[model samples]
Target: MLGPVAAWDPDGTPLPLGAPRHREVLGRLLIARNRVVPVGRLVADLWGDEPPAGAVGAVRTFVSALRRALEPGRPPRQPSRLLVTDGPGYVLRAGREAVDAWRFEDIAARAAGASPHAAVALWDEALARWRGPVLADFPTAAWAGAEQARLEALRLDAVERRADSLLATGASRDAVADLRAHVSAHPGREDGWVLLATALDRSGRRGEALESLRRARAALAEGPGGHGPGPALARVEARILSGTGGSAAEPGGMAGGVWDRAAAAWERSVPARSRARLHATAGLLRDLAVTGAEGLGEAREHRRDLVAAAEATGDTELAARIIGSYDVPAVWTRADDPAGAGELSRAAARAAARLGPGGPPALRARLLSVVAVESRGDAAADAPLPRAADSPAAEPWRLRAERAADEAVRLARRLADPALLAFALNGAFMQSFATCGSAARREVLGAELTRLAVGHQLPGHEVLGRLIRLQACAGLGDLAAADAEAEEVDRLATRDERPLAGVFTSWYRALRTCETDGWAAARPRYDALLATAAGSGMPGLSRGAAALVALVPVMRGDGLPGPGLARLDAGPYRPWLDPLLLAASGDAEGARQALAAAPRPPHDLLQEALWCVLARAAAAVGHEPVLRRARDELAAAVGESAGAGGGLVSFGPVARHVRAAGRALGGP
Candidate 1:
């Protein structure tokens, strides 16, 4: 199962597993994880859509041969034990220890939580189970491809993990040869390059380490998608170039070593620590923080410690950099933590003040950009900017954010660094929520960001740029371009193992289905998107999806169930749903009052969908004023699909909503 799918006798001599088809039958049963695989499934799996008249007979013959070979010493009248006949098919009753692949998987699973020494031994044992390519004898069998790929990925991961353990055990030089072979065999694996370079560098061959990184970039560029060296590799190269001796591995690969080096450097005396070392550590920690939710708390704690240390040393630039290093991809401008954002914003301001007016413009730009993004926290709502009386306060914050973003971009342009420009462009795009033409502004910024990210080989920023473009495309009604961007987003997310990046893509796909078909048809897709979002720890996306799931009945003019209305009221989209829910509940006056008091939604991705919901609610309650307002706001987007920008839900064509509002207002 681990390699060629062959069997051996108990004493060590190999037992011939009959011919190819016989082996395939055994392999199929084995792949079922000891469950019964019906003869019909085996025949279909072997022969696909078409099968011969004697296909069932051929399958039985193959299974009989496999049974005989597997239980060669069984009594003539005894039933087969290893490959026993079940109701309609055969079952491979092999124990876990009897199968190499199962044993390998068990070992790898255990190695995940083991100490370095133990992990290395376990990974070694796991790798030893693989003799060659998985299911090598069934190369042409379509059924084997997925399992083979899964096993191969596990093998490669084990190899990398073993190297990481070796590095941790201070045997970096010993891992060099294996890592070199790894990158050569799997050029597209960014982690392999990082490990190989780290091994070379730790072996006192800095030149070769640098060359390995260059080769990695070249190899990745030549691969199928022409992706550049990913963020982890870029951080590794930066650390190596800074001479910080930081471990060049992803957070999940060798997090202990990376964090230990960073902690040691940060604890050093001010005079002893170089700015380059501080930069390297900060970059490493920043990448770790954004890797997933598990590391976020620790990364934030370390960031605070580093900030305090920098403040003690009067290193304003370092403090500012540490405070502003969060570069997670954001769709909505709302802050996740209002209190934390305020604290960081104040810290950044203090750092800037300490630096005075003539400090490094680049550092100042970065601090200002962080402030701009953080100031979006008028409240702690995870959804888009809510419409309320206090929303007026958010207006001043939005204005201040725009001002700060403008200055940041100007300073970034002056510095002429592509990375800085990319950062500034992100802030600019985030703050591009002015009353009019916001989507156009975001589209332009998105294009510039994409170009800069591509030119500099910043794959993370490239994905961000594409996400911005994707939103812009959807908002601007360029469904074709939006579809392409969604496809590319999925590609990059898959290539980089960034599941969070695929959340938006999943949302867009479901929204497209909703537009083409109807809400009933798209319900399953939205449900799946909700699951993905929740699994990825994106509460805002999940909340919005849950709200949309509840609104489907309202859109269909069906009675809103109690549980559905409860879910609708629970999310941040409550304001947008209030009027709809009220009208559905037969509270016409309450519905009209809610629609009248509802301030226009912010000009973000969800604006169109929110407006459509409001319009429908107003029409249901005969609120002419609200209907006319919805009509006017949605007029320009007549040809577009509502909710396209947000990718959460859809109300079909915007024209439908606009026309409904117009009819309700006694116009067209």
Candidate 2:
């Protein structure tokens, strides 16, 4: 580590760190350094959601304090020491001499090609300088989290690379075991799984390697929940698996290099293109992707290349409106980015508006829908986004995305495409539920959704948010249909790997196990969920997902018949605990009434399913008319779900619930 110097002095006398706010502002600036970090980031990171009313003034005051402290003597030739004021932001000018992290990155990159032993040595030296959470004493500021996550992810990368060097040089078994623990410690990370899988595969544990593949698959499937190795990881896994007797073929091209030759030919043809030539070339590439499974990734790269060419021609606006397609926004909300999340959303909307037509009709529609659902109109969820609609035209991308969604829906309507319209509607529906909490609208739309979606396969390019909302419908006394939809989720989620796959499976299983005795079954699902949740390391969403799922067990059987619901005290769901408590304390009737009166479902299906159980207990108590009404509503739901089947159980616990309710009420 570089010692405190006198001239290039990081420690001439230790400048006053200043007051709390000032310390915070200085901390943010110092962490980011000369990169022009925005003012909004400073404010958001400083105070989060509830920044004080005078946050701007507060920030300026903090900046002034940083200047005074850092410039103990007369000011240097520059604006100030360390923290330099820049356009609409401040830049910290530490360089390598000032920042330990900068030095680590520089040294680590150089070590990338070094010998395994030397590389490990270099990286270990670079890594050892960490105290507690690099900035643990710092508050949970916006920029702080961003920088923290980035640095942590980077450090993890370094660690993995060191392990890789060790593995490659045959010091891997112990190295692999260490990596596996780290990978397990940090689930939903691609490199960890990749390294762990490699280690396990080398140890003659291919079965475990396959399981690691499942972890990678799950992590990747989390849908921007984590940046779990997009296509790059896919390529790596294909290489690994094919080598492990899975038979994927060499990296470049599989079909005797036909696809590679075709890809190269198409790549060459793309640059020197007339309108006619461009169209013809695009057609050839699409046809080629359809020709074989192996060429799809190459075809996608070609697609990106074509889009780039369009950009260079200065007709991007024209290109997007003609060929660009809608895509899912990043799942992170724009609140994730305080300064420009708005502008980012506007640009996305405008571009989507323009390029809303190009891309493959179905693919574009689904892409746009998924992006809308993900971006849900928020930008900061920090998920990877498909490229924006070709950037042309002036549209506002504010934090609120109803407008963007409206635009996407408008585009779908303009095309008069049923699939796209449904696709777009799903996005709008999510926005409505997220923004306005409207269940009736979803119910009305649910019928159309069922009609449009049944037996129809969605295009490969899509998000599963729409499918998730279908679970919401079932929670609203729409059991029969919910059962069918849950079954579909089971099928879809079976292939899911870690996070969402686990969430979906838990939801599906918990819903199917909808009885008093079923709680035991629910335990394993919850255990699986807990494991998945721990693997995720994203507590808010994971715990939130888990807390919501656990509500099912809380309300099953006579609405918390005895002491059965007492064991749910070990979690953090301010939203769910109350209803479970109410049910467990023999307030079954009250719980049912409260749930029915509310008409709103909890964020998790578990809670929604609990509502059903509670309502049944209410019916068993003194509300004959209300009970009959609930039954009738549920019976119609079943008939609606069953279609010509007329209120028969479709085939699951949900079906059983409806049937049990109908028989209890002496209804058809």
Candidate 3:
């Protein structure tokens, strides 16, 4: 039997035995309806600290009386006819008309539809019958306290709504006053301050508005995410400090309902007529957009659909919450037009403004940042932007890497659909580590990574599984495993460019000069990678590799390697190609001094430092500072556009001069 719903039919005549104790227990049971109300909890709520002799008997007696009254015509032997037995207690299955509690909820839902005046009037009328603290007319027990809290929460809701209507209708001052009281009545809530601030700001009292936000922040910092503030309040506060919104949250990359396959999810999950899949789907979408769901797009979408569908199935309260996105940092990892990037950033911000409370905060923040960064014209991202899309000077091996890294970030926050959000994040992070080469990031991405591996994403979780092991192995200094992961990455490589794994392979090969011989030697696989990377434009690390490899082949000779040096200077790729050119000329003294002018890290790993050592030995070039900068880039390689983990590393050898002067540039 289903549990009791809120009672309706306010005019129905009251019936039966007048046992106060039984009425108290029945009210408690009705409130908790479907769930088990433990014996200890019931007793705690029933007797407080003072249970009389045989208090247990008293409870049984009350149960017996209530059953007899509710089911007078039923068999005397079946007490469960009125209250079904459950774990340690009983479940009351009365109709809504027989239970006032459920009826209260119905009234709340109806309030959303009513006119301001009608809504307030209707709820006030309904609330008038809450009648001395629900089940409160009985003993002061723990269960009674819990029941009171629940009903009080509803009462608070009424007040909040009243305030909402008032604010919308231009009674901002009144709304603030009412909300202040409402917040007090429901202390330590994040939404309260946001609401309070909104009302105050609307009323033209800006300082107090900010204060409200501050209070909320402080309170929420303590935990439970209780102090959930709304975006409107933050906007209001922003206006107070500046003409425009202050510190406005940056946008994300994924646009609005564009990705929302809500309709599709609904058709698939819901039943014939009474189907409720939309509710579940919407909720899941909201959560995926807001919290850390996964690294796959489809998984996130499915979860969102499930949430929406569930909400459609009579979970109005849940449905009401299913809205908007999170501020995951807007960036346009997609190497498209700058104008497009700007629009994407703004859209991301708007989407985040709509997000309520969600779990994927890290992912959300990252998404917004991706958009914002892109809009800023991430010249710092892949660098050499001018040559990226169409420069004969581009490197082939890095095309996929640049695209993959940028795409991964875009995809990460780039979703309104839960599954897309997850897959993208997974791809973004894995690709980020692989191309950028950051071990620290690799360390912290586990838990969220695991979710991507689970039901949150793909059927096999195979890609993510491999990616994680790859990250772990890299972090632990397991070179063998790292190389093993590289093998897998190679197996999966395709023609369009696999930025994630492909970049990992290419960069690793270039970093330590590992593939410098192959690229510099017979075939020019590395050189081919550079020449063909035109479609998506070269990524930063790829450009770095081009310059680095150009210096490789020139080092194949003896003494000063002068003849090898001539190969590089002859190419039209001169001004922009100076770094590699200077190093390979064996004017070791001249090159080191040239680099000393700008001590930024060149692309190669320790090879830069190795070049400095070699330059010092050659003794022709003089300045040590340039060598120092080159060495710095080589050794400490921080934040450079190099791979971090997920199977990307700098494993190439001493091609610092060899590959540059010969293959990539011209000769050999």
Identify the candidate with maximal TM-score: 1
For each candidate, C-alpha RMSD in Å? 22.8, 26.9, 22.0
In candidate 3, stretches whose alpha carbon ends up further than 4 angstroms from where it belongs are 1-451, 458-479, 487-524, 527-531, 535-547, 553-580, 583-593, 602-620, 629-668
Q: What is candidate 3's CA lDDT for residue 286? A: 38
Worst 10-residue lDDT window, candidate 1: 385-394
Worst 10 residues of 2 by lDDT: 642-651
User: Per-prediction TM-score, please?
Assistant: 0.56, 0.35, 0.33
Could you tell me the C-alpha RMSD of candidate 2 in Å? 26.9
Question: How many angstroms is residue 30 displaced in model 3 relative to the true structure, after the best TM-score fit?
Answer: 22
- Indicate the worst ten consecutive residues by lDDT in candidate 3: 248-257
* Model 1: lDDT of residue 303: 67
List model 1 lDDT by residue over 472-568, tens digit each.
7776677788888888888877655556677678777777676667777878987776665555554445655677766654554423434446544
Per-residue error for 321 in candidate 3, Å, reads 17
**How well does candidate 3 score on lDDT at residue 571?**
27
Model 2 Cα lDDT, one tens digit per residue, 1-668:
12211112354455556666666665566665556677888888777788889888877777776666666664555567567777888877765645666677667765664666787788777776554465665635555777777778778777777777666566657676678777776765556666676666666777777787787677667735443344434554565677742221221112223344346556665665566455565566654443322343355446555544544566645454323342321121212223233333333444455555664444445445644554433342343322111111222332245554676677777665655776677666545533112334555655555555442333211224334444445434455655665555545444321123334434444444542235665577556656655543233235444444454443333344345344544243332244445555777666555444432222211222332443455445444444444344344333222111111111223445566666666666
> Which lDDT tens digits does candidate 3 get at residues 101-163?
666666665565566667666676566556555555554555556666767777766666656
| Model 2 misplaced stretches (Cα beyond 4 Å) | 1-344, 350-371, 375-400, 434-440, 443-447, 453-470, 489-506, 514-518, 533-668
